[model samples]
Target: MKSLSIQEINTILNGELVGDTSQMIDGLEQLKNAQPNQMTFIGSIKYERLWDSSKASAAIVNENIRIEPGEGRAFIKVKNADLAMAKLLEEFDPGPPQFDIDIHPTAVIHETAKIGKGVKVGANSYVGKNVVLADGVVLYPNVSIFDDTTVGPQTVIWSGTVIRERTEIGAQCIFHTNVSIGADGFGYRPSDDGRGLVKIPQIGNVIIGNLVEIGSNSCVDRGKFSSTIIGDGCKIDNLVQIGHNSVMGRFCIMAGHSGLAGSVTLGDGVMIGGSASIKDHTVIESGAVVGAGSGVMNDVAAGKTVLGYPACDSREMLKQWVALRRLAKN
Candidate 1:
């Protein structure tokens, strides 16, 4: 583990220091689990009570907090303790190991494909006709990029990920293992004879904006007509499904196993919890939150938090639950 002086940590966090400045902090830990040589933080007032018993030698705290005089513990006071802690953890992180091979010998690149400077294609990867990989893009083993696809600079597509035709991924994006982008949307119509389902062709592509991170095994389907869009800084958790023609606004978060059906529109900063499902053609306005295991069947206003099946306002759901319990007792 890397160690830093208390003074150095204060400088890194741009925080005001109180108490001892010469202590060595070797690692970061939670208040409940901190060792004497480790650093910890109190991000909320709820955790302030933990400070007295915490064994950490140094702590990061908000500037507004008042500390008793003559305490032996060291502190770095910042504007936001949570953000400061995030920066500290980032500073301590040792990033992924670099590979020696820029373009592995086993990788196949079509002659028409444009590979930019500093791009790395790992073993058994395939880049197809007219594909464009911008500078600093990295494709790990067994990855496939189909015809006419474009990936922006500094993006990393991990092993077993596939980017289908006409898909466009933006800069600094990370697609984790087994991700599938621009797959055909699930669309069907009855046959002329009314005997079986006929597949409706998915002719549109997917557009992903910059700084997006898609988790492992997630799938984003292509649109039936217009493009399916994922806006800037959206974070999609593992096993999530984004259906055809859907548009997600900037900084939206979709937790694990959450799904959006075809033509759904999610406004900026919408949060979808685990196992939440939005019906087709639904609109969720900006800053709305769908609770875990929710089934959202209609439009949700901006800044609202909805919960339960056929989700309603959270307070209403709680009241309903209370009424149901009372009736059950009778």
Candidate 2:
């Protein structure tokens, strides 16, 4: 077991220690489920009440919380318990999945493809003609990289992922399992004589910047003419759908199941909560926050927070909700 003593943990967190300094904590868990050999954190006031019944002999707590450790337990007091927990999790992370081969025998590499040093291509993966795989790039089992695509150094693409032609992926990006990049945009036009629908030929690619992380099963569609751009440090969550020609600025975060319709533009630091849907061609400015379950239909100003259907300003939505509740009771 990989264990850390109370004294060792306090040094790493630079926290003030309270009570016993000798307990060995082998794991970290939630308050409701912690074992005696594990540590837990009470990051929010909502969880503080549950701490009394927890079996943990050690805990990390906020400095503002003034409770002493009971009995033989220990507590490490820090500025923020949640932030401390994140650091601890990084310490315990075992690193990415490891495969033994540099390039598996079953992987198909085209004659014209250029693979860099230290690249690891797993079983049944396909690298098509004119593709470039940079140094330290990892393609897990069953990944498909189409012709003319270029992946930068240290990018890790998980199993079952697909990269379409002409796509450019920057350094240190992570594409989780089953992600689809540069697929055709959803575009259709009415045919002549109104007989049937005609497909719009999507000829564009996707450009992803460095340090981007896309969660499992998400899809980023190709543009109609140009590129669908995702800026550096963007984090897109599981099952998210980013439509054609959409441009996301640096450090933008989209939670699970959130979607951006065709050509949507998001400025730096925009936060999209889970299940929020932004309409086509809408622009969200920097630092704006869209609450969960909202359906946004228009532009959102910088640093503004929006909520509710046809998403309005958060303050306006609150007033409307209050008025509707009052009218309902009458």
Cα lDDT tens digits for candidate 2, 131-166 = 999999999999999999999999999999999999
TM-score of each: 0.92, 0.97
| Tens digit per residue, CA lDDT, model 1, 179-237 | 99999999999999999999999999999999999999999999999899999999999
Clashing pairs in 1: none
lDDT, model 2, position 28? 90
C-alpha lDDT of all candidate models, in order? 0.94, 0.94
